[model samples]
Target: MATNDKQPVDPVVRARRQRIRRKRARQSVVFGVLIAAMALAALGAVAIYNGAVSMPFARGFSSTVIPADDPIVPACLVEGKEKPIGYKKVRVRVYNASERRGLAATTAKSLEERGFTILATGNVKTGVQNAKIAYGAKGVGRAYTLAAQIPGVVLQYDARTNAQIDLTVGQGFDGLIPEDEVKLETGVPMNNLPGCQPLAELTPAPAPASAAPTEDATASS
Candidate 1:
């Protein structure tokens, strides 16, 4: 395998070998670059998962998909199960049972401001002792929401009323329930569409006035 001059290694053969080496070097560089890029991508993803960036999770709103195993998920993100509904969607008629001539009109205006759709306002056929919300079979949940925003208003399910709901002002009527005090229940109940857990679920019967606690009594207690 050894020659005196080695035949000068053949010009064409030497050129081919040089080309092969250069090709191999280029391939190696490309492979290395690909590997580095993959590593950087993985690191960036890890950083995001570790709280390096802000997330969109917020209160009273839905969020993007979240991994069940993720520890940073917020408690507010739980499935609301509560359908999206607006107060204007609920139809109601306010009646003045308090013997106040313009009480019905005033109450109607207030309810309208709160997004309730008042079909009509008038005096009650039979004067009520306490403000009450009467609803037909179709709008119990909507009715309950309205009643919640108005303290001391008891809910009564009546199938006869053709409209969605009715509000009757009574002799003991005080005023609209404070927005902060009213807690809207958000969740799908077991009842059918126009049905809801009986009014008792949200509003318990009010304690008799005689048994009411005065500020002085409460302070003493």
Candidate 2:
């Protein structure tokens, strides 16, 4: 009796086997990606934890400080006119109710909180027992000046007498105010005061653009 030779597997059966192998391979790659993602997330959490615990002033620096007599006052208030040294168009003054300490850092924090970007900081000068600080703010081509006086004593008066802030916002001769309005105690209040608006908005006419030569124009001409 002749034995029947076994035929090769059918094409459909071979194709099915190949498909199953590919499916398993894809599953493995997906699983590996998920594991990597979880590990990265854990590492990020650890970094955040370390930063929060080790950071200085985690709660943020204080904006309020006791106001003292300003050192720049004598120079600025000369002849009863509060003339800024490097006068710009717009300026804003922020008052701290606490005596000055870490003033540069504090002023930076305060202005940033109020959505102002600091362009420059002036030098700090010594007073009887306090210090005077100056900084400038710029946004949308408009400039603002900020000046603060830090008192020597930290005492709380019956009313907030020592703490004062002056915000001046304007440009050129148009924004200039009278001598009395620029003073610490007598200057216009920031909230109810007029003319703190940005210069770009108030100015009606756009600056004229430079003329461009036409391509057809002769080189000699």
Candidate 3:
């Protein structure tokens, strides 16, 4: 008789309770998935930081296309070191080894006005007395050309294989000497200096030319 007194539960209330339970279950599932994704991301970042993994986007390109140690093609040395090369043909980089600021830039400007190609300008670590012209074995003539412009410039032969010249100005450096002071020969080949390397030795051997096509081969083509 006491159990019969309890009323039956409403169908509408039961359906509403079921819907709330389903919504809570879906929310919990979504939260768990988010936490798992965040944990994986954190692990990936740690791996990259420890150098255990490399990212493709982190690598960068090299500054230069050719390696510095690779051999370079020699310039035209038809006259060798004895004869002077034209100022326009000389490629130079001006470096200031003195305490004076902007010396390299000013010197480079002056050389540019004299028809010399200024490649770069910077400061050097070692100091010099007057100035030094550094050139490679194949750049002796080019160095001579630049030496004519700078007074009391010493020529230094290095291990480089190209024709580019480096002009390092020192504490005692002044502007280029007077044009009349430069001693150079315009035409006529001069005798090579004692113990000087010949052009044949300095220049690399030319590659053999390919055979020309025959008349019959051309006609067929």
Evaluate model 1: give its TM-score.
Answer: 0.46
Segments of candidate 2 deviating more than 4 angstroms: 1-7, 52-221
What is the lDDT of every predicted structure here? Answer: 0.59, 0.34, 0.67
Candidate 3: which stretches are off by over 4 Å? 1-82, 188-221
- The weakest ten consecutive residues by lDDT in model 3 span 212-221
lDDT leader: 3
Question: Roughly what TM-score does model 3 have, to 2 decimal places?
Answer: 0.49
lDDT of 2 by residue, 1-221 (tens): 99889999999999999999999999999999999999987887787787743444455476644344422311112122333323333333322222233333345445555444443332222232332222212111121123322222111111111212222111110112233444334343322112233322232222213112112112211
58-145 per-residue lDDT for model 3 (tens digits): 7457542321121323333445435677778899877777677777778888889878998877776654667877677667678767
Order of all candidates by TM-score, from best down to worst?
3, 1, 2
Model 1: which ten-residue window has the lowest total lDDT?
Answer: 69-78
**If scored against the real structure, what TM-score would every candidate get?**
0.46, 0.25, 0.49
RMSD of 2: 20.1
Measured on C-alpha atoms, candidate 1 has an lDDT of 0.59
